[model samples]
Target: MKRFLAFVKKEFFHILRDRRTLLILFGMPLAMVLLFGFALTNEIKNAKIAVLDLDHGPHSRQITDRLLSSGYFQLIQNLNASRDIEPAFRRGKVKLVVVFPPNFSQDFARNDTEAQVQLLADASEQNTAISLTNYATNIIQNYKSEQAPPGTVAPMQIDVQPRMVFNPELRGAFVFVPGVMAMVLLLVSALMTSVTIAREKEMGTMEVLMVSPLSQLQILFGKVLPYLLLSFINGCVIIALGVFLLGIPLNGSLLLLLAETLLFTFLSLSLGLLISTIADTQLVAMFASLLVLLMPTIFLSGFIFPIESMPRFLQFVSNIIPAKYFIEIVKGIMIKGIGLDLLWKPTLLLLGMSAFLMAVSLRNLKPRLNQ
Candidate 1:
């Protein structure tokens, strides 16, 4: 036992003495969180909207005020004719062009009179078009409801307006690209980290380390530190791609993103450590990591499917997966732009899992090679 204690001390020295590794340990987590946080959300604000108000009457002005007051839309143009809409849409300054057809008030003169507002939105941006359309519809409907019922109202009415948000103009691929990056990053980091220590053993390096005076805990730290850093770098790569190339939003607090990412990185590294202790070779390690971390995180993490829509069993099972929490934190910070108060639950869960993995790893480490 004394010898084991001495060994642990020696291993710690090797790691602590290496400044490069320690720097990476701290740097990687912060970088990855910021990158992934921005990459994983699609909610857009401050999108440009164009108006072609042919009515020039109280109704058109009222509709315009309502849209602006909602704080969801910004008007880009006021056109006297409907023909100007297509040209504006082509100019790309307008994602959605609103056309209040001539005599819009005439239709609204009766309490139930039918009015048609043309919302020419860029279908290219699916989510933006859809979101703006819904808001505009709701605003118009609310205005109509306030008026007395006109002579037998038209059974149906449609109001269309196109104002986009974020990547306004909902380019579908633009939506999930960030979340996909988070998934890929977690997989790359977790899988690589899981196999690394096992690879050292397969190459006979672990035997030499085990025979050294350094402690097992130190050895474990040294191994995990490298992959943790690497995983963080992978996360950074994902973030850069999502932000610069994909134009994803980074509206939330950068600090919160980093803190959450660090917790997740610690959890992933510890999980990799647990896998290393159990596996005999790098291939087995790789296979095991994929089976344990890859499959579960992907299917259960709400990356592709809505968590609420999932089966109750799946919903319950997701609580145990570290990736689940990471996904939530990523979406919450990046997409929702929410703060720590709302995110503490997932953050705490991740920390608890990391501690559990680290504890089990320590208990599992054998004091001697033969044991």
Candidate 2:
């Protein structure tokens, strides 16, 4: 017990002594959560569009007014002909181009309407285009319904109700906040440890420690244990940021959140140890960590993009990325309020991955010394 206490004390000293690592371990998670929560989102807003109102009547004007008032599309240009829309879109000045047909209001008033408006959207902006198209369709459909004569459509209608599932708000931030935590923590902690270890080699302290009487496990723990604590604290920092700074709710069990957080911390540290084992230089370790860990964790982890919708090969590849499992665990706990009973599969995968990384790292680690 005394020796264990001494070991833990040394571990704390190792972490607190390094100002750079301390700042990153505590600061990066908070920074990333805020950035993702505030700056980045799946929902596109205030999208700019150009209009070619050819009808030149109440119908076209009403359509323009609807698009302008919907808040999804912003009308930036008003052109007289449909031909000008091509150049505007070609020059990338607008995301959508609306063309209202001729005599649309006259046709409507005569009850001989066969009017249609063309919505030409930039397919390059796929997600934004889809959202705008959907909004336009819904608005047009509502307008058509309103155009129906009184009593032609039911005065009042009874409808079956549909309520939201786990996330009623559909805020998207609820999903991203937890995911960004997993991603940023993995990047910051894993890169920090790997690069720090490689730097020790560059500076020759690794040799000095090797020559000492410290066991390999002690030396390993002396490095990673501190990062583990820092990572755990960083988890707390992110939770606080999400709850207070971002106003993201923690709807599930705190104990579950902590348990999953510690698991994720170990998972990332294990990957860091593996990276340190493979690379002798800090630069290589950093590049490898960023390329291998940071990008995939954000892109492939079902954090922002749905894994099921990805290509089959990508779905297979994402399964091996430990960040995926951790993100699922944290998101499940924080956003979905899911308990361990429902999350055992991902939890086991993370634990297994950590165990595998430890074995591989220890095996790669020179019991005597690195040449």
Candidate 3:
């Protein structure tokens, strides 16, 4: 037990002594959280819009005021004619053009049945245009509601009230933060462990450790323990940034979240160890870790895309990516506040993968020692 503790301590010293490793261990999570939370978000803010108010009436001006006050849009141009609308969009000054028909205020005041406005959006950026249209529609609808006399029901009106659960405001950070956590934990744990072990091989120190009294399991555990601890810390840092900085809610049990994080870290570390055992050099191990672990985690894990929306074959391929399960586990725990009852399947899958990888890594490591 003392020898095992000493081995763990040696690993810690090795990590602490290297400034670059320490920076990557601690700094990368913060940088990624800030980058994803602030820069890489889908939420539209200050989107430029053009208004072509033909009516030049109170109701049209009121609608424009509502849009500007809502903070989603910035009025960049006022078009007098239809010809100017294309020019505004061509100049890239506006993402959308709102055209109020002639006699818009009088039509609404007379309660005309067919009062309407037209929204022309730049289809070049499809998602942004869609979001802008939705925002404008919501603002216009609210304006209409406000203008309507109290207790007056419109014929064929269907009231649709949307309640956004978890992230009510639909902040993109809420979507990306959990994914960043999964990707960061997996990449950092796997990359660091694989590179560390491969570096030992490159430096010819692995044979010295093999000659020592430490068993193969002890040596493997020693290498994994430091990274496991570090990865857990990294996970905590990410969760903290999400909650405090990005306002992501952690509605489930904190202990459960941490336990699940530790499980995923173990899974990543085992996979890294397996890579280290197979690859002969640090470069090979690093590339193998990036290509094998990082890309799949980012693309197939439902990190940035929906796995269900993917084709059947790609969905089946995603099953092998451990981050997919971990991301679901995280969103379940953090966003939905669901307990183990809802998350048992993914938890079991992660556990099984961790055990399988650890077993394979130990098997591979044992044969190498004999050689």
Q: For this target, which candidate reaches the highest TM-score against the unseen true structure?
A: 3
Worst 10 residues of 2 by lDDT: 154-163
lDDT of 2 at 206: 93
How do the residues 1-371 of candidate 2 rate in per-residue lDDT, one tens digit apiece?
A: 99999999999999999655565576667746654565445554567777777678976687678778876777788877756866665444576777666766666555444566677765433445566677777776677667677878623211112222344444556667777788767876798889988888878799898878998678888988888899889888989888888776677798988988888898888889888887777977887787678877876776765453454566688899887877767766665566787788888988899899888877887642457
Question: Can you tell me which runs of candidate 2 are displaced by over 4 Å?
Answer: 1-162
For candidate 2, what is the TM-score?
A: 0.58
Clashes of each: 14, 0, 0
The per-prediction CA RMSD against the true structure, in angstroms, equals 15.4, 15.9, 15.7
Instruction: Please provide, for model 3 over 124-173, each residue's C-alpha lDDT reduced to its tens digit, 9 standing for 90 to 100.
Output: 34446567778888888877776656788642121223323345466777
- Residue 256 miss distance in model 1 (angstroms): 2.2
Give all candidates' CA lDDT scores: 0.67, 0.72, 0.78
Q: Give the per-residue lDDT digits (tens) of candidate 1, residues 217-321.
A: 687778778767776776667666766777666667877877776677778777777777777678777766766777666565755543433445656877797
Clashing pairs in 3: none
Off by over 4 Å in 3: 1-159
> Residue 68 in model 2: shift from native, Å?
34
Candidates sorted by TM-score, descending order? 3, 2, 1
Model 1's lDDT to the true fold? 0.67
